[model samples]
Target chain A: MFPPRSQRILLAVLAASALLSAVSGRLNPYFLDVALGAGISVVLASSLNLINGFTGQFSLGHAGFMAVGAYASAMLTTTLAPRLGLSANLLQWVFFPLSLVAGGLLAALAGVAVGAPSLRLKGDYLAIVTLGFGEIIKVVLQNVDAVGASRGLTGIPSHTNFFWVFGSAAVTVYVVWALLNSTYGRGFLAVADDEVAAEAMGLNTTGYKITAFVVGAFFAGVAGGLYAHLKGYLNPGGFSFDKSIEIVVMVILGGMGRHSGVVVAALLLTVLTESLRQTGAFRMIVYSVLLIVLMLTRPQGLFVWPLWSKKEGRP
Target chain B: MNRSVSGPRSRRSFLTLAACSAVLAGCREKDGDTGAQAIRLGLFGALSGSEAGLGQYTDMGATLALEEVNAAGGVLGRRLEMVREDNRTMAGESATAVKKLLSRDQVVAVIGDGNSGRCLEAGPLCQAAGVPMVSPAATNPKVTEIGDCIFRVCFTDPFQGAVMARFARETLHLSKVGLLVDASAPYSLGLASVFRERFAAEGGTVVSEQRFSGGDKDFRAQLTALKSAGIEAVFAPSYYHSGGLILRQARDLGFDGPMLGSDGWEAPELLEVAGRTAEGSYFPVHFSPENTDPLVAGFLDRFRRRFGKPPTGVSALAFDTLQLIADALRRAGSAEPPAIRAALASTREFQGITGRISMDSGRNARKPAVIIGVRDGAFRFLRVVDPGDPGRASS
Candidate 1:
């Protein structure tokens, strides 16, 4: 958790982010477009960062949890909102949060289900399992009629705006960052530092690993809920393997264990992606060239070069 | 609930922030029109990516119509301007592109979306923004069902299937048929089901039915089964890529009946893959370049002169879509979004490059579908299937 003084500033930053977002969203949809996209990316990266960075679990199923959360929450809102007999405003302001939380909880259970088997496996093996899980989820979703099958589910209320998106982003960051300051977070760090040492120290490494995995999945689910409502449409293709890899890139390029690094990286990638579409035919060409140049210039990450690096032996 | 109350100070600020944002939203609820002189129309589609091979035709067609409309003294006494954006053939990108077009470009009408999924993503926003969007080639039934503001230049999916079944049963005199459906594709599956139902109702027997996923290139087994059944024709409701492979495979297996398909075979690569075997194949297209109609000929001439090649069916549909928008604008007599939508809805007997197009209340175009056959490495005109052709027998 942030110190008391730092917490106040963090709270202020959150407040200002919301205020700026609202103003931009209202003034013109273009700014809202950037903010909304960046905000979702922030949530997704921050959640995945909890697992892949702090816990050192190489989970590639971030987008799968996101899809599950998105489809579930979207299904609830689209089907129940009208039948709940609540006004549209009330449905969004009140019931939507309930659906988002429910979606997150379900995603957490899925994370547990996938984690229980593969957490004991080593790095690349875990990555393959998680990657496989992602593809399986996408394949399963494609065949499910309840979610509109391959055609995708439409008529999802556009309940997501800057406030909801940035609000969820703030909440995701706060919860994950706060966990890093908790004893459970220390267990996660111990496991990442050395699983053998963590086990010898009676830290229950597997339990700690599961906690991080569940927390990561929960936030990813929340991100999915925001995404579905924002896009007002959800296709299995939207949450493909490429999407899962995208979040992993943010976590890696942001730095392994730095919150601000992940935040900056997510915003950069999302805004860069949407803005670069203006390049027309060359957007894809520019995207790969930019990534290659960045990789060559700073292999550690875009922002992980100095600010958050550990300086040892300073005393 | 108590925990959510974080602290008195933070809670107060949160409330203040929400109130402020609400006020701001109210302030900008109704944006003031800048009242630009030019009537801005928007076009969005896959200008790049896998589908771009086909979608590029759509881009040219819309751009050509924009040029033609502006050259003929514009719409509503204003030079019609097109603000085109590339959707990149992705789902979320289409929604983003439409949002930008509606807000940033402030386009009153959008003509776009050669693909159905992309159109579905963009349709909701156009409906919400009170802007009209006409999809040039999206054939899914759910697209127009999104809202009244969303319309399409092409016929709906089921109608396309029925058109093919009629062309096969009545025109080609095929009594039995086999279906090689791609179960993974929504477009393929939808057309397959409709064709099956319509063909069965026509007293035509489906002696053989085989299934294949979209990416499956090998269909020797399915082709072998079709050979055994001795069906008169095979209806392959697949895109050009798979359609070409299926036809080539079928020919290799020595099943030489008339291979029927839908507009999914509009791509030039279909002929390239199947080669000489692609000739004598049939499919229903919205517009055929071989049409001797004056309007169709003029479009083909202009298209060939501009792009150095004749326009494909998608291109022709896109050109007609833009012209339809221009026609609606002329009839509405204003650049107002609502009036343009009304004009688009009440569109009747719109004689364009495609054909005479009328809109049902569902925003679907009621028009004749042209059945095209391949011969000598080019699409040749077969016959026009009228919209209300009777003798639709029950199964």
Candidate 2:
């Protein structure tokens, strides 16, 4: 069971988010857009946290899985939803979530296909493989005429709103938190700490690693679906290796396996990036400097070690 | 197991979440006051990417136009202010730039995004916000198709491609050609496909076709392949950076045949990169500096006096685009976006430095493309290819 106070906090956060979503139409469109972006970042960073943080797998191709999900779901919404002959509300409310689930399933399958063999390699080798895989997906998407190739897939339905984005973020956070806390999830920690010892102790290390990849990739796919719908456009360049690096930075900056820390980092990074846009041409320079300062000052992740030192029994 | 739920750490995490929300809310202050005296316009482009050279050209052109307008008594008796954002030629950045321009800067009009893909990315956002966007040189046919509020000052790829194809087949009298297409750029892809189709229709044979990604410096492999095919000309539809490299590489590979290009090759950096090897290569542009028209001579004189160099085709397009917007504001007699949109929609026979520009039904500029050939490290006027004029070129 989860902690009672944490549950209260989660409930309170969810209620407030829902209330805000209800009145989102009245809010400034710019802030609403930023909030939706932050929500997607939360989903991506949290799911990435499950693999790279707790499971100790370095995946530089999370964006590849996201691309698979984005393209798969986008194909359905743009190509299939119209043929269903459903009404507007029916298509959005009923068919949209189905498309997202289908997209996530495809991404999970891709994860298994990629992770089954590649997960055997650890650390830097695994990172290189994932990075290559991300590029492969981008190049393949670029040549696929059905998805518009390098010209990019446009006219995607704009069904992603505050409710869908935040609701998915909440679900992603809960799944990642609950799955890691349960007894069955201890195998993941063992694998992360020392794969050889866990294997000697009769733990299915490969299974845990594959499971982490599958689940992580699944949520990443869902996040991609949300992203495709939010922007109403999808391009291979949107899910390039640079995109995967962005998610990794979020997970690392949030302190690996700490769920709350990752969440906070995602929110702050998205907000900081948007706010820095007002600085004109030096926006990116200012953002990089702030990130460097944060990393140097708090190398253990922005908000993790200080608060959880006592709970995790660290010095 | 630790049983405490309300530990100080958990409370702190909760406070962090609250603080995050507070920051988001605090940044939600009302939009900038529009009651100011200046009529603001938004300009955005790839200011720091592989296409940064083109960005510089556009920025310089817009600045010159801004200064000229202000010097000639401001628009509607109010100073015209331009707010610029750099998209960095990256995906999704254009949408964010457009959002900031529309919501925060509250500009009456937006003019920018010379590349088609970036223009498409920002088109829908401007349409939804009821703001008009004028692109200087995004040549894709699909750009203005996004919505009513989206417009461009350049000819579409379909027209540009056909013009190039006809020029290569008829003017050059070349029966065989090689194709070098930029696979990554929508602008290049669109132009390449149309050229392929149109060239075949013109009874010209494409002996070989090769592809290279945008920003690729090593074009020897592709260029060597095209040279071996023994084609008379190579049509490399790419931006200046890659186009210039292709031209130099083709010459180095001993392909003396002319390398035909689209408007994407109009930047001065092409001459800088290709040097003397760029001679005999030809490309279609919005306007040629070699025009004998007094209006063009006057514009070039002022541009040279200001920038100490000849303005590229994009800079000219940018200058005309901003002038078009200012003209709309003057005609509308108001700084409101809808009124400006209407004035822009009614643009007719507007005399520009490029040529006479009229907004067609599709919101595209109905104008001719000027073919400029590089001779002795200078761009010289070749011929004017009117729309649907076939091969009749009046030199």
User: Which 10-residue span in candidate 2 chain A carries the lowest summed lDDT?
Assistant: A306-315
lDDT by residue (A1-315, candidate 1, tens digit) is: 756843674576578666775566455665466557778888999999989988888998999999989988999999977887998788878899889998899899999999998899979999999999999999999888788887789989888866677778877877877788765667777788799998998888889888998999999999999989988899888887788988998888876766766777787777776667557678878987988787677666565433233341112
Q: Tens digit of lDDT per residue, candidate 2, span B246-270?
A: 8888888889998899877877899
Residue B107 CA displacement from its true place in model 2, Å: 2.3
Clashing pairs in 2: none
RMSD of each: 6.1, 5.1
The number of the candidate with the highest TM-score is 2
Off by over 4 Å in 1: A1-25, A200-202, A275-315, B1-35, B173-259, B264-281, B288-301, B308-311, B374-381, B389-395
Backbone clash total for model 1 is 0
Candidate closest to the true structure, highest DockQ: 2
> Each model's TM-score?
0.82, 0.84
Scored against the native two-chain complex, candidate 1 gets a DockQ of 0.26
